[model samples]
Target: MSQPSLAPYVLKRPWLMRWAKPLSKWYFDAAAYRKLGLRSDDLIPEESEIMQRAMKRLTPKESYDRVFRMRRAFQCSLAHQLLPKEEWTKPEEDIRYLSPIIAELEAEVTERQGLEAMVINKPNTKR
Candidate 1:
C-alpha cells in the first residue's frame, strides 16, 4: 500500500473539521474522533522515519468510522498494529511513537475549543 501523508493544515482548510462541528458537539464534542483521525491519518508517511529515529512513536490504526461507536477501540488496535511487539520491546518505547500525533491532537482540540486560539500561536510542542 502507498504511504500516508502527515502534512499539517489549518482548521478552515479541512472541510471535514469545519462541517463536523455540529455532530461533534453532539458526541464527545468530536475531540475523541478528531484525535483518532489525527493519529490514524498521520501514521503512514512518518512511519519509516519515526520508527527508525524515534521508534517509540506508535502508529494508529488505519480504518475507523467515528459514527460506528467503536472508534476508540479501533484506534487502540491501530496503534497495536503499527507498533507491534516484534517491532517494539517496551511499551514506553512504543509510546514515544505516539508523541507527535498526541501533540497534534491536543492542538486540534484546543483550536476547536477556541481555548488557546490557534496551533501557530502555541509553541511548536513537537516532541
Candidate 2:
C-alpha cells in the first residue's frame, strides 16, 4: 500500500514548495535508494492485490526493466556495494512508472465500491 503524502499540498504553494524541495531532496539522498540502483516505485511490495494487478498492467519492457533493477540491487546488497556513480539511478530516471497504474487501480476499486453501495428506486408503472 502507498504511504500517505502531503506532497500535493506542499507543491501547490510556492513558499511551501521552496521550503520543502531542498528538505525532500536531502531526505531522498539520505534514503540512498539511488545508490542501490532502484527507483522509489521499485520498492513497492507486490504482495497486495492492487499491487499485483498494477504490476500486471506494466508494459513488457517496463516489467523487464523493473526485474533487472531488482536483480541488480539484490546483487549489490549481497556484495554490500553501491552502484558506480554513473549507473546510480538519476533523479529523472526515478520517475513514477508504477504509481499511476496503482492510482488508477485504486480509483477503479473506489468506483466499484461506490457503485456497489448505491441504492436505486423505481416508480411503479400502470399496465
Candidate 3:
C-alpha cells in the first residue's frame, strides 16, 4: 500500500507540478484502467489488512460502487474488451476515495503505537 512516490516533491513546487500534471495524465491515460471504467483507487488490491479496514470504512454507496467497478473490470478482462468511450472514467471522476481512508487508518495506528509507548513518572511523595 505504501508505494514510493515523487508526488510530495512535485506538489511542493508549482513549476514542477505544472510540468508533471500533463505527463501524469498522459501516463494514466496510456495505462488504460479508465477504458475499463475503473478509477485509479479501484485498482488497489484488497488483500492487505489496511485496505480491508478502509473498505469497511466506506459508505454503503461507495462500497457498492467499488464492487460494481471491480466486477465490471473483471468481465471486461474476461472478454478482452474495454467499456464504451462514453462510459470510461473521466479525469475529474478518478478522485482518491480509498486512499484518504487508508491514510487516516495509518495515522490512527501510528498514534495508537505512540500512546502505547508512553511512560509516566510520579514525583516523590515523601516531601
Off by over 4 Å in 1: 1-95, 115-127
lDDT string for model 3 (1-127, tens) is: 6678999989999999999999988999899999999999998888999999999999999999999999999999999999999999998999999999999999999999999999989998996
Q: Distance from true position, residue 103, model 2, in Å?
A: 0.7
List ranges where model 2 is wrong by over 4 Å: none
Off by over 4 Å in 3: 12-15
lDDT of each: 0.42, 0.94, 0.94
lDDT of 3 at 6: 90
What are the per-residue Cα lDDT tens digits for candidate 2 across 43-106?
9888899999999999999999999999999999999999999999999989999999999999
Report the C-alpha lDDT of model 1 over 20-115, residue by residue, as the tens digit.
656545664233433333333333344454333433433333122212324444655677633333432222322223456545655665677895
RMSD, each candidate, Å? 17.4, 1.8, 1.8
TM-score of each: 0.20, 0.89, 0.88
**How much does candidate 1 score in TM-score?**
0.20
- Shift in Å, residue 1, candidate 3: 3.8
Clashing pairs in 1: 56-93, 56-96, 56-97, 57-96, 57-97, 57-98, 58-97, 58-98, 61-78
Residue 5 lDDT (model 1) = 44
TM-score for model 2?
Answer: 0.89
